[model samples]
Target: MTYRADPARYDSMQYRHSGRSGLKLPVISLGLWQNFGGTRDYPGAMEILGHAFDAGITHFDLANNYGPPAGSSEELFGQVMARDFRPYRDELIISTKAGYNMWPGPYGEFGSRKYLIASLDQSLKRMGLDYVDIFYSHRYDPNTPLEETVGALAQVVRQGKALYVGISSYPEAETREAHRILKQMGVATTIHQPSYSVLNRWIENDHTIDACGELGIGIIAFSPLAQGVLSGKYNSGAKEGTRAASSNTTLRASHVEPRVLEAVDKLGAIARARGQSMVQLALSWALRRKEMTSALVGVRTLDQLKDNLGVLNNLELSADEIAQIDEATKDGQMELHPSPKGWLR
Candidate 1:
């Protein structure tokens, strides 16, 4: 069947400026990191993608090393784009990244100029895209100089392989340095992707959020639900096929300890008082920051996507509510697992 998007898709969706750039991204962006790989059902993936667009999710976030075999997600996305989204290409924001172990060799990953450039070329090919709206250096590399990584990103823009450049998981100091270097190269760092949620607040402690605000860089928070811990799905314990139950997944059952579940339970009660689900509350909290351009979420089903989009309807939180959430999760240490590509898994 030919997929025709809902004409009124944009009626309720809110678009926010990406940093100081002229581009605006949907506040609730979709991420193709998990459950959209080769092993997953193509028809099911297409259904979720179609529903996301129908509900005004224009930004689709991806990375080169997303799938188990690596690059399979992009390949799947390419097929979906060719089949259903070809005509609406101009209406979407596609972004991909590099900086993880994509291939076996040393040249296949990291922040080096050679790796970034080649990886993006491969990513563009896999996605069947001429250029991604944003190309990110997926993570900071301590081995490479800041100049080299920023230069590679700038070159991608100059080559028309990417419209803008971004960095992910860089520390505050490194993020500042990257922004400075990119600005000197005549291309300002457009956005910064980070892992932030009620249970995981590293960005706040590291001051990355404050730095991005000062530098005019947009923040798109990944793992806003703390790998479903904040979603209240695991509050009772890991069920079948949940991230905690899946062997191939990064989020393990050990990570969700008693303390974490207790925190989640308290948070859930707070969410109920606000008349929202735990997922909605977590997402709304992540977007509470003015510097947050979007809250990038990953979903396996269309129902999950719709529930995430409900965050847009009620984003307001009183100061007291914020305090209650803080107190609830303060004792829990449920940070996302560290991966080569940061916490977007």
Candidate 2:
């Protein structure tokens, strides 16, 4: 069956201008970080992609080290693009990143010019694209000179491999510096992908959100549902195949302590009162800021995708609701993952 996009798809989804750039991204973007990888479930992945496009999600985010085998996600995405997305390429915003541990040996990871350039080359080959809409440095590499990493990112744009550049999980100061460097190189930082959610409010406390606003860089929050914690799915316990229960996932059972579950339960009450699901409330909270360009979400099924898109139905959050959510999560701590160089702290 031929996949024809829904003609009225643009009628509902909201699109926002990315920073000061000419690019306009859907407020809710799809991320292929998980469940769209490996050899199995190829059809399942395709179905999810199809549904996302049909729902007017124009952005698809990926990274080099996303899959279990490291790069399988891009390979899988490549196959899906070749089959379904090739005709609609111009209407899509496809982004990929490097900077995590990929492949063996010294040059396989980090922000070196050598690694970034080579990684995107492999990514392009894997995704079967002449150029990606946006390319990113997955994380800040303290060991590598910021100049080298930023220079490599600028080079990618100049070489026609990527139209825009961005950084993820970088601190506020580093984000400013990266933006400055890219500006000097005649390229503006399109967006900053950060791990921001009600539970994970490091962006607020660390002033990364303020920094991005000051610098006129758009923010796309990943894990806005706090890796499903805020989705109200774990109010009782982790179900089988949930990220918290899966050994391969970053979210562990320990991360979902009783206190956090209590916080989530309270938040769920607020969502129900407002006539929305927990997932939709979490996403809307993330997008409450004007500086936010989009909220990147990953889903395993078509139903989940539809639920996430339902966020656009009511992005409005009253001041009292915000206060209630703050009070609910005030006691909760930001769950920090250990980075390799201890710089993420």
Best by lDDT: 1
**lDDT scores for all predictions?**
0.87, 0.87
Q: Candidate 1, which segments miss by more than 4 Å at Cα?
A: 252-254, 335-345
> lDDT of model 1 at residue 192?
95
User: Would you estimate the TM-scores of all the predictions?
Assistant: 0.96, 0.96
| Residue 212 displacement (Å), model 2 | 0.7
lDDT by residue (85-137, candidate 1, tens digit) is 99999999999999988877889888899999999999999999999999998
State how far residue 282 of model 2 sits from its true place (Å): 0.4
Candidate 2 off by > 4 Å: 335-345
Model 2 over residues 1-345: C-alpha lDDT tens digits? 767888887888899988888899999999888677774477788888888888889999999987766888999999888988889999999999998888899999889999999999999999999999999988888899999999999999999999999998988889899999989889999899988888888888878899999888989998888787887877777477678666667775545888888888888889999999999999999999988999999887788898999888899999999999999888775655325352321
Score residue 190 of candidate 1 by CA lDDT.
91
* CA error at residue 28 for candidate 1, angstroms: 0.6
